[model samples]
Target: MPQANWFPRFRLFLLGVLCVVPSSSLFAQEQPGQFVLTPGVVVDRSANRIFVVEPSDALATVALQSNTGEVLWKNESATRPLSISAGHSLMSLGSVDANRLGVLVLDGDTGKVRAESPLNIPPEAATLAAPLGEGRLDATAVIRGQRGLLRWNYTPPVTKQGLPPGTLSGLPNAELIPEVAQPQPALNDNPGGFVEIDLETGEQSVVDPAAAPNFAPANDAPEQPLLPEIPGPKYLSADGRHVMARERTKGESHRFMMLVFDKQSGEAIGKFPSNVSYVPFYVDEGRIVLQKEEFAEAIDGQLVKQPRQLQALDLNSGEVIWRQPIAEMKFRGPPPP
Candidate 1:
């Protein structure tokens, strides 16, 4: 909960690059390695640290233990994912042009770019994506127009593909996955198809959910595509079957909508009341974190000092486990759950 101003600021005067430039060209003075300031929407946490990407397109990789903030990275243009996922590794995505795009993969141990690639994966708009777990960690990216999913296995001896240039493909006996159906763009939309890749035979199954009795459609309501202004750092459960996200409405009101989806079944679990950001969603454990707030007139003629609180929610039972006021914290923003 550190103030935005508390972080480091790069002084442009130190760089002689601006000396030859005229004053009129200066719409905004650039920091040595920073982007224009904006409120952050995506937050990624791994181990003990949290990385917050500001809306201003600046990157702040913070050490949660020390409560100390540092400019681990930055961007020059106004971008979408101010901060992407920073865990055992960090993934960052940005636009290079209308059709062209780029991705920056950073080593989690040391904030350094391990790879940079152009927008080769289909047209789907995806943020930072990294493979989780051990053994042949792969990168999965959503393919926009094709209504499909694209994954690249990057466990070395990288292969080259026609479209996604650097993507390894058609290996003799490697764990490679070519494509998958894009999950329906509706709330709680269940995964309609399945792909089973065998390590020995390299066989795949495009099983339709409709044919399988074990599977069920996601939600009872109509499908809704994710809104334009959703906060990222989308949380995937330990199995990567569920995703927790915040959908926002732009403008003065800044309304926010909380959504939980099961990627396996393509189902909408539940939408909570009020806007909440720091929620922890674990589907298998039947646990979710939520928050609520209210404003009232103060007893003294001053504004009410407290309006925010947090709670633990049980998704299956649909009940509240606990509630606590967020007033005692020394920070200025919402307290962590």
Candidate 2:
């Protein structure tokens, strides 16, 4: 049997982690020499806005104009975005900070705080608050917000208890018992349990955080003869007329690639390999923005793989509007550590 993939790798297995693509009015992915975007990016098509969360330290949330890539607002009130809500006008997130602890909502257009609710969990709740190693990106916290409800992960304070006297404690040679070593867990691997809280009420409950959220839209689209094969998490476009997801392929070290299909016609519009990690992606106005691998040198084996490049590809015209390295991209907040 295949062992289960964990958080990130595990979430990538969700197969339903879909995003909607715009069917009309495409725009430039980003203004050259402007903002840099990472995974967990969200696009609000209705408002013509783009949202990005700094994955590393300084966990700030930023809003940019989708067309011009202009900075609208950036703040730390929301750490990790769970999903876009209330018709793409609002974004829900897991909020954790020095004094505040709870669920946070932001205005999609302006990065302004629309509402804040206290979570029964700690500000350090969830792996999002967990310290990231030198280079880690998977946020295992079971963060999800919908219909005024929120779910996130938090580490509980460890309690100490003495073991009860073993029946064999007095057995002969019991004093010679061996001390078995306890296995140490890898950081950023476990997601732990999620604390489900009602945004309207202070009510809270713990939910299983072992698995990723299945946001895969209904597979109502008739299967087309050449529909792009989606072997991983599938993202459905906003209009529910298109679908996008990753498929494994050969010819590259990263076996997984991206594919988009017309849900109605079953025709493949786009298919290619990219930053294959289970990073968040968004499709809007006939354009898809994703992380593209870059290279410092072509013949010298200088590929910028550590922090890849963000690229926008027009699905309608098959044109690449913009592309930039993430580490070199400009922003208004503290440097991404």
Model 1 residue 220 distance off true place after TM-score fit, in angstroms: 15
* Winning candidate number (lDDT): 2
Model 2, residue 66: C-alpha shift (Å): 2.6
All candidates' lDDT scores?
0.33, 0.45
- Judging by TM-score against the true structure, name the best candidate: 2
Q: State TM-scores per candidate.
A: 0.27, 0.50
Going through the candidates in order, what is the number of backbone clashes in each? 20, 13
Look at candidate 2 and tell me the lDDT of residue 244. Answer: 69
Alpha carbon RMSD to native, model 2 = 12.1
Candidate 1 off by > 4 Å: 1-46, 57-87, 95-100, 120-337
After TM-score superposition, the amount by which residue 11's alpha carbon in candidate 1 deviates from its true location, in angstroms, is 24
How far off is residue 105 in model 1, in Å? Answer: 0.5
